[model samples]
Target: MNIAYPYAVSLEEDGVYFVQFRDLEEAFTQGASLEEAAFNAAEVLTGILAYRLDHNQEIPAPSAAQPGERLATPGVEVQSALLLRQARAGRSLSDLANAMQTSWPAVQRLENPHHWPTLKQLDKAARALGKRLVLSLE
Candidate 1:
């Protein structure tokens, strides 16, 4: 599914930052660096989407990735990469869970747009599904 929600990012203080999405409230964080702020914003967006899904609530479309934007947070990038790799490798969620000795729900959470798994967890999932986690250097 395509997501299209618009968000604005702003600095609130020395280390604090805020990300505001349309029709959604605001999310804040105190990152040690600018990159860290963008990264947290991605996770914040992921968690918000997951909450909306878990509660069967309405979700807003994904917003465009602004320049200097983390684009897709590392966590989200990991999640998306795993799913695409598994799909291309002919591996299903069931296959992954069985191999990893975990519940399919765990796999489900990793793939679901709503469930933004931690980057560490995403790496494990990618490995479990016979996929390798990679980050492209720009």
Candidate 2:
């Protein structure tokens, strides 16, 4: 599933552009211009997702974008971590490690948002979870 979250951008009375994610109430930012606002939106989204992952908080699924709402995606590291966690689906880390033929700690690191797993590692994890890794350009 695509991991891009839908966000609404509005121009404030003071001329700043405000961006807010519907699914992530705590994620919001403002910029001086539309371009800056878009950029800030992505950064904030990534930060919030990373925070949630680090804190073991629930990561909400991205809702379908409504008309006039733009999509903001988190960084690749966050995406990879979330995807791996979702694919595991409550399976134990040791179970996944056995399936991937890797050490348990290694498998644990795959779900760490701060650790950037190689593509090969991600693909192997995906395969072990009976899923295929798919990448796309927005």
Candidate 3:
């Protein structure tokens, strides 16, 4: 699934551009310009997602982009972590580790936003979850 979240950008009277994600209410930011707002949006989105993952909070799926709304994607490491967690579903970490023939901590790292798993490791994790890893440029 595409990991891009849709966010609305508006220019306030103070000339700063404000960004807010409908799906992630806690993720919002402002910047001096539209470009900066877009940049900050991605950073804030990544941070919020990382926080949710670390806290074991719910991570809502991204809603479809509405007209005039742009997409903001978190960094690849966070995106990978999100996908791994989602694919794991309700399965236990120990179970996944056994399936991957790796240690529990290694499997746990697959879902860590700060831990960058190698492509081979991701592929193995996906296979263990009966899913395939698909990469895209956009």
* Candidate 3 lDDT over residue span 15-118, tens digit each: 99999999999899999988999999999999999999999999999999999999999999999999999999899999999999999999999999999999
Query: What are the per-model numbers of colliding residue pairs?
Result: 7, 0, 0
Q: Summing lDDT over every window of 10 consecutive residues in candidate 2, give the lowest-scoring window.
A: 129-138
Per-residue lDDT tens digits of candidate 1, residues 43-103? 7766665565456465444466666443433245434633443343556768877876789
Candidate 1 Cα deviation (angstroms), residue 35: 0.5
19-133: candidate 2 lDDT, tens digit per residue: 9899999999999999999899999999999999999999999999999999988899998999899889999999999999999999989989889999999999999999998
The per-model lDDT (C-alpha) reads 0.57, 0.93, 0.95
Q: Which runs of model 3 end up more than 4 angstroms from their true locations? A: none
The positional error of residue 100 in candidate 2, measured at the CA in angstroms, is: 0.5
Which of the predicted structures, 1 or 3, would earn the higher lDDT when compared with the native?
3
By the lDDT metric, which is better: model 2 or model 3? 3
Candidate 1 — what's its lDDT?
Answer: 0.57
Which of 1 and 3 is the better model by TM-score? Answer: 3
Tell me how far the alpha carbon of residue 13 in candidate 2 is from the true structure, in angstroms, after superposition.
Answer: 1.2
> Which candidate number has the best lDDT?
3
